[model samples]
Target: MRSLLLALVFALVAPALPAAAGQTLTIAKARALPLGSVVTVGGTVTTPSGAFESSFFDKGFGLQDGTAGIYVSAADDVHATPGRRASVTGTLKDSFGLLILVPTDVSLGRQGLPVFPRWTTTAGVSESTEGRLVLVAGRVTKAPASDLPYGYKFWINDGTGEVQIFVNTQTGIDVSRYHLGQALLVTGFSGQFDTSYEVLPRSPHDILG
Candidate 1:
């Protein structure tokens, strides 16, 4: 009778226990999970905390490992600067067209070298490059416009194709200095807004004549 009673107690207690965390995945594999699915990923922080800001996401940082990269959103500044390795557990979310991880927990590992930006042309920025840092050079094909209330945008074209460059107000990057036909080297995270893919410069330092 006591053994049966203990069995019943064990069954009742088990239901209240929290579920185990999902297996750790590479950033690329985590990005493949269905939206809203919980997952854990390990990578090196590619952006300093609060370096990139947007209305569509919380203040956060970018993370990348050998496989791929992703953005991690947190309510508060995580202070996970570039080159710091971290393990993030979160639910997958689609912020506009950009894939992001809304972290429930973040564990920092040892500091290491940050992932370098891949050099590509305007035509090369696409879904496969999303969330990774990239460098692209082109002439201004479209001038600045206030498409987003918090930011300004312009388009650049290499001989190959065109890509948008979005400067968020938070970055204090002055787009007014650029004009049609100006040649520039731009570097930033590859991002998507709705159907459009863009390269977002983190600061004036990311832009060069």
Candidate 2:
């Protein structure tokens, strides 16, 4: 009788247990979950670890799968580079306006080619593009009046609409060469800052005029 009672107790309590670690969720599905929910996602690393000097991105990197992409924050603990496949478990967060994952555990997998940048128009860059690499070509519609402490901010339009291009100072990409009306081909990670959606080039090579 005691054995049966114990078995019944175990069965009743098992349903309340949290999910096992490492049960993977696609990047898009994880993004849709409520904040503070623990989730595990597997994807290819889109940005090199420690690439951005800002504390906001320090130790963090970007990851993307077939469904979507997302930035992993405060993940200096894991060694990741562009093209590396990784399985990360973390809690979802909204840093400023950008959605990010704060990792608690990370596991690296086989290396592969980095995900190709998707070609899209300036206006095509929306919430869906965030955390993914993209290629855009447009004329410089608005040039930076002055450089901000973080970097330069400019606008580009490809007739469909206009989008902001933010050249972070840490990347050492000089924006002075890009002037108003100049046609430019740019490749970068589609990201957001506060309320504005912007493209962030990883290096000077990401820009071609």
Can you give the lDDT of residue 58 in candidate 2? 66
Q: Write the per-residue lDDT of candidate 1 for residues 1-209, one digit (tens) a residue.
A: 99999999999887543335667878888887789989899988877777666544467888887788888987788788778999999999888888999999999999988678989889999999988989999999999998566689999999989999988777778888999999999988888889999998877988998
Q: What lDDT is reached at residue 130 by model 2?
A: 91
Across 1-209, the per-residue lDDT of candidate 2 in tens digits comes to: 99999999999888554456667888988888878989999999987775554535467788999999998886464668889999988899888788889988888999999888899999998897998888999999998655566678899999999999988777778888889999999988888888888887878888999
lDDT of 2: 0.84
lDDT of 2 at 73: 88
Off by over 4 Å in 1: 1-22
- Displacement of residue 109 (Cα, Å) in model 2 is 2.5
Clashes of 1: 0
Looking at candidate 1, what is the lDDT of residue 6? 98
